[model samples]
Target: MARTTDGNPERLAYNDRVDRLRRKEYRMLKGTTYLDHAGTTLPATSLVTQFSHSLQTLLLANPHSASASAPNTSHRIVEETRLKVLKLFNASPEHFDIVFVANATAGIKLVLEAFSGHDEGFDYYYHRNAHTSLVGVREHAASSHCFASDAEVEQWLQDEHSFSGDANTDRPTLFAYPAQSNMNGRRLPLSWPAALRSTSQRLRTYSLLDVAALVSTSPLDLSDHAAAPDFTVMSFYKMFGFPNLGALIVRKSAAHVFDQRRYFGGGTTEMITCIGTQWVAKKEKRLTDRLEDGTGATHSILALHCAIDVHDMLYGGFSEISKHTGWLAKTLYERLASLKHANGRPVCQIYKDPAATYGDALTQGATVTFNISSSDGAWISSWKVGQLASSKNIHIRTGSLCNPAGMACALGLSSSDVQRAYASGFRCGQEADIREGIPFGMVRASFGAMSTLEDVSIFAKFVQDHFVGKGLLNVDDNDEKRVKSEEMRRSEQSSTPSFEKPGLRLRPVRQQFWAKFGACIPFRSRRPDVVSAH
Candidate 1:
């Protein structure tokens, strides 16, 4: 039996089971630390196996065909998977209708397109930390508003309370926000969805919670029907690590919004005139049938069932996954935050609340975004760090990370400054264009259920050796006291927790993970604390 750090048999059995799954999993690319789980995950080994087994045993044809038994099988599978997805979110059939889409982007587009076809205009309010897909919804709105921070968002809603619109004459209003920020892994208030419905009586308020990032690490409880979002968009691949698929969950009351769909395809209509003049859409349109434009990604939908099964087997549930990954993120954050130069200047600047506790799942996810600085106080290039990490097979992400507003806030860039940079060729995926002294971006390292403490230690050791002075290993006086206190608190918290928490155990470094970086440079007794570029 594989043993945990504590040598507890129950924990050992749990780790052993996970280890077996990890060994069977073929998706883990060789020699990569894969610190970019926020981007995508490695599918479990059994996901593919289960999918193949289903293919071999069941006859699944196009779900649109009503006359054939094979189509019936396909239909049944699709419905079952839909329920599985709903159950995964703790959503009920009476409250939410699932619409299949290409991915989360497609899901958002569907809602935007349907809403934009309204005869009346709409007021759109979105968060600054929203993903690019959510940001695109502004184009479909009559008027758009943005809030840079949670405080700003709350204040805006509060100010709007006094203003009354003619409910009979005014257009509907929609609020869009990511449940969790994809850039820095900040978990926004889940209560925002229900609050919007009650925000104003004079306007029809609907909310879309983009759960693309949130579902990866934790469960989104739509079980509270009263508090659920009008629409929720998510990509399954982000959760299962394979088979790109997405869903748009529409509240039953909001299903009428999809009646505005201008175009119909394949199975979306009931009858058509012979002269291509008039068409009759299904009068009692099924929620999904109206929104799913054409033939679905059948194979991917089939794979989703297996993915959920594999996910549950591996991690028990999101709660366990959340606790484990939360521990890893806090550990990594604390280590990076505690680093300093000989002059006591922080070696890194983290773009998150410095006071976030280790086990707190409310404020953050398993993602850390930060920038390292030279002892001289000049910012080191995050792109360069990513490149170096890549050379060592430590796969991470860098640059603005597709959240322009979040990036702007983190880097203190003005709108004009961002526009100027964009005009000058600064963009996502072009991190190489970043010249030295540009003060461009921050590095991001995000973990998942699959990550281990050795991953954190290896990363810490790398930053320690390459980015700070050897003498800087000693914690400053103030930091020393803080570290001691944090340690005491962590010890107390972990002692009573039922699950085996990660990051509490120190293991031998995974030397192979850093082998390509060459032998570690000897620590000097005393040297200029400048971060070496070499």
Candidate 2:
């Protein structure tokens, strides 16, 4: 782990070192491709070991009271970890404060409950492609609206600026959106937050950016408060690959809205007493202290510090991670898009932003969602593909993936179509629904910092051999060969150098990747009858 003259580590010299660490540090990599990084990542060995050792040796007392020595020490650790979280986002202590929550869902709920006025009407706008947690915030707002596309959002913003009404202009408006879509891996425009404020000074505007997906493969900068979201939420595990904790980051400029909260909790109360027939209460003046109720996840918060250290060591920070995973995703996307049947029809139907590219970290991440089809243009069951993937130890995700609106919109399914399918006994996890030829789900393959070109190649070859070549006129002999252990070892070694190489191009990796594991295809039978409708 030494550095060269220019302060950059010589990647080639440490190739053997990384190889040894890969085998020992990441236990989850053994016998698995682990393409479900969007859902959750395998915890690092160092993180787990250090956390366990600390728990065994240290006295981690509750930070609720200051009457004892243990509690004081716990309080110190909690405060220090809070600063680290803020530093990770490039946020300053003067303008930003962090509140620990159960997860990203809890963070969103805290904002909606604290900001939304029940008596005074306010408009809540969010993208239709948002996660279920973001969509659920509509219930707390006075009025809710969903924008189908980015153009629709732009038109609504323009209309808000043109309207000439004193009453409507005075009411507050909150616009929440995802930095990247968990369903399709499409990155949205970051300039929308500033645009909302520029629409009108009369409109009390605020932005809530959901960075759950964006933080998994990229960074979210809050150094420039003018361009950053007024409130941002993300889960710590999404960034560190361990601990199930989340935080809500609030800008001091917009912290006043939290004063509207009606209730107080244990640590949030500064003074509470009853006088005669009435009760008097005073809340903590700090924004985080006022919002965080009950006791925080003390151990998880401490582990977050270690997770950050391990994250920095493994990927060298978000910029390096973005470059590494983006190339892997782009390579996977292009290869999957290029697969064709004997009749020259595309075998995969991918959903993504048209403007996104592999080199553009702002537009895309290491996630790909698509469906496989046969030569006669018949769709294959995504559930079936997922089951096949499990047999090959290739982990992936299927179904709507917790974003119903985005899933339905991506497949071009109408409201009536969804209702009809629902009435016919088709549910989210029902395997029989796939046989009915209903567009119920899609297959997703997500990459991360630990992902290599071999993982991408195996997934591509799986689709080509089992789904595409299974229904073709001619099949290669390699399609019938069983993947031997020695060949797998060769594939692993040939693709190992890319892990330490920064700014690695996709073409060279693909060339060397396919050279070793490209011919290793899944088993296929003779011409099988196509399942067209189902």
Candidate 3:
């Protein structure tokens, strides 16, 4: 709930502590400042170490025989990881089934395929801002509807006239929604899910939550909410661990309803035979194996386990992490407001109410978005900011970030306009040329368990200074070298070449060389290797 004051040395000192920790935690580039935890987080040392150990063990074992020697070890690691995930979500082991998949998209597909095949004629509902994977399923489903708001959902359920009577008319419905959006970092109301559950019970429908972003932060009482929904999906990568893995938690009573067509061949089947013989499916009660149709990413799973363990220990558990992230978000929102451009305009246009407490705004999680304003010639596109941050050794992501629906809804921009803006290299609404007006995407600054208060202040100062052209915190000679090299290339291209062999032959060899090395040279480089030397 606390606010950060600009030029407050106490807050700046706190930010410095976070920066130091980040340098240690991520081995970031010197002078680089990372402010983009929402897209992904740097892996903790524990996670990296554990991941390496698992990989080494797998590599050491002989081909086609690793499982034989390390069967129990592999299973133990997976079970332990699952238990960690269970603890994070506060779900019981018996009711929750954890099946590791490639990613959130894969998990969504598996669930959609299973639920859609039932021929129950159950209506599928989702928000307009639902993830693409869920959106695709909704589009494909025979009976599906998307609601713009909570009121729309209420109206749809009340109107029996909208429903076509069928044998499974009383069957439960499926609702898909994200806990936090990747685009704007907007946290959807938790009350919405509970309300959906209540509506589902009265109307004999079911709700399935896509809690991919919320798994690391949001607190849900599974016991009380279990009956309302048949399943929930979560992703491991978004929480600062391994990539390419997700899980689906299904209730015990509704487990039988899922029809399994193995997407891949391995571990999912109990037995197999050829020549008109049959393969025995894995036990129904063992729901994890039901959906885990392929060989597991044992190493990545181990990393995920390590991440969760380290997350609990260092961040004072998920609850404390959530609190820390909220504080950081609040600090960022407040500080960014004080940033001014060279024209004496606020650099950031924050959308949320300034008076709102961190707890009020971040009840769902710590994700916030705002527009960045810059001078005419001194532009910093979101993409450019991401690139600049990366050049400074910071890791951040920018752009619509695969959430066109949310961008459209929040900014009132069409999909084509958003695409064009990115293609044209504009960062926000204020940055775009009015004559060539285009809808610009919002810049998101997200925080997580590993984020410190210092990260917020450093990033805030960077934005403020960058807009005013007072020299960014981490700009180096390399940037000037790049500009100079570009100028040289343009000059060379514009000047006519001296042709000894006069067939008007284009200088292919020279052109190729220039093209390759043109961007590599720094603008102020005394020698080409000088830039690389640093």
Candidate 4:
């Protein structure tokens, strides 16, 4: 049984039950402790089995057949998966059009391409800490603006407020922002979409939400709001499953703007044409099939279907999963706050406001960001911690994590300042040259459906052991035997005869190989004449 910091046995046993269930539920990778669910998650065993079955039985069927009596089993599977995805987001079939693409980047590109012609007076806006794909979209749009906060975005959209009355509103504006940011795991308020809609209505602009991260934590319901966004994009892989599929759900009103023939060929058409001959477009079916250009990944789509089913079965539901993650996050934050180093210095500075309510805490999602402050005024990088943890079979990630702008804002540093500090040997949480700006980034720990109370406890204990310079946890008799065997090997090697001896030189062979492939090659030097040199 795993005990909490207070040493309460009752609480420990309860938590242990949860952990045991999680262990039995998830097919955890052998010899590795996973904590980077934000990057990707390990799929459940059911998903794998279902994926294999579907791939073997149905994936090879031709998408387009001339036979009128052809079976639509594959199409049925696709539709079922689409319905599951719609259910996950609480969206209706008509209002939300699900177009399956390769991945998140492809989805973003398709949406941007759909709105390519309306880039006249359009100015793209995103938070300073948005995903790189959004930044890339802004660059492609060529007329983009960035804001630090919600207030700044609202202020920018106002005509009578800032920059005088010359506020340009010629083209349809698109704001590509995350529902819950991947970096630092910060969940934007529910009011954010409504707020954007309210402001954009006055400015005659549109909004496109990137809800890739938020899908795992909560069900997105866009029905009630007076002002709704034009489109939203999400990825299935980030939550739990396959990597090659993504989804884009567009508002019904904005459906007509997507050109059917923009990027053509394959299953998107009814018939091909010869030179000067007219072609037929499949207009009778739904718009989703019209936008779907090629034969979809049947196996991956089925895998996603199984993934959702597994999520529902094991985690109970999205609400229960959220509760579990929230509990873990809150416990981790509180425990990290109370932990101290050997010299009585706090290991991490927890960020949650003490006065915030439970609802307010839920708004942040299940992610904890902290700074490890050391006693000698030095600080530890999350990447370094990740490396240390990996040596003990635990896995995590560090650095700005593709949100350089957000990292800059949160740490109060300029882009150049961050670059310079990183160029120096400065770790996270260390005070640096203020003139260059604030000098550290945040380290984030995120939770998923399979993560349990024991995982959190193990992490807390690991942190404590590292601070006090102790051995790793779960080091059993096998590890001791391995260490003993390694020591014996070293002793045997020491007693063995030296390689260097009279007339028994093995150095010449090594030298020959070394000369053939020198450590450093000179780019400017001419190639040796192999025949003449030999």
Counting clashing residue pairs in each candidate, in order, gives: 0, 1, 9, 1
The CA lDDT of each predicted structure is 0.71, 0.71, 0.56, 0.59
- Tens digit of lDDT per residue, candidate 3, span 146-236? 5665456556556533433232465556677776666544566555545644543344455567777665554555764444356677777
lDDT (Cα, tens digit) per residue for candidate 1, span 1-534: 111153345534554455455656744654567788888877876788898998899888888777879988888888899999999988999988998898899999988887787888677778878887787787677776667667766765665642223222367777899988898888888887666667456246788889988889887788998789889999888888878999999999888777776767777777767575765756355878777767777778889988988888878888877866777787788788778778786787777733234457887888888877777666676755765565466878787777767666666556666566666755443433243344556688987767766667778877886778533123455544554455455556664433223533211111111001111112111111332211
Q: Write the per-residue lDDT of candidate 2 for residues 1-534, one digit (tens) a residue.
A: 111121224322233344465577887788888898888766789888888887787677878877778887778888988898888889998989899998898999888877664358566788866888888787766666667677767887677643222325456778899998898788899898877777556258789999998899888788888777888999877777888999999989888878776767768877767676655364657887788888878888878877887778776788866766787787788788877777777787787756566557888888998877777765676765765576578889887777766776666565566666767755564444353454577889997766766677788887876877455222244432322332344446675443222422111111110000001111121112222111
Query: Any runs in candidate 3 off by more than 4 Å, and if so which?
Result: 1-24, 51-69, 120-122, 154-172, 199-204, 216-229, 260-264, 271-282, 340-345, 351-364, 374-381, 385-394, 415-436, 468-534
Quote each prediction's TM-score: 0.82, 0.83, 0.73, 0.76
Q: Against the true structure, candidate 4 has what lDDT?
A: 0.59
lDDT of 4 by residue, 1-534 (tens): 255544545545545655666566564644456677777766777667766776776634554653543236667788899999887777777677788887777778887776665646345667664777676776555466666665665675553234223335565566778777777566665555566556535444556777777766656776653455677787888777554578888777667667523666567767667689766655436777777777777767778888888777666666656666667777777777677555565666543322223224345667776655454434454544554565566656555556656655554455555555556744332222222222254467777766766667777777766653222222346544553454355446665433443422111111100001001111111111110100
Locate the minimum summed-lDDT window of 10 residues in model 1. Answer: 509-518
What is candidate 3's local distance difference test score? 0.56
**For model 3, what is the alpha-carbon lDDT of residue 406?**
59
TM-score, prediction 3 = 0.73
- Which candidate model has the greater TM-score, 1 or 4? 1
Q: Spell out the clash pairs found in candidate 1.
A: none
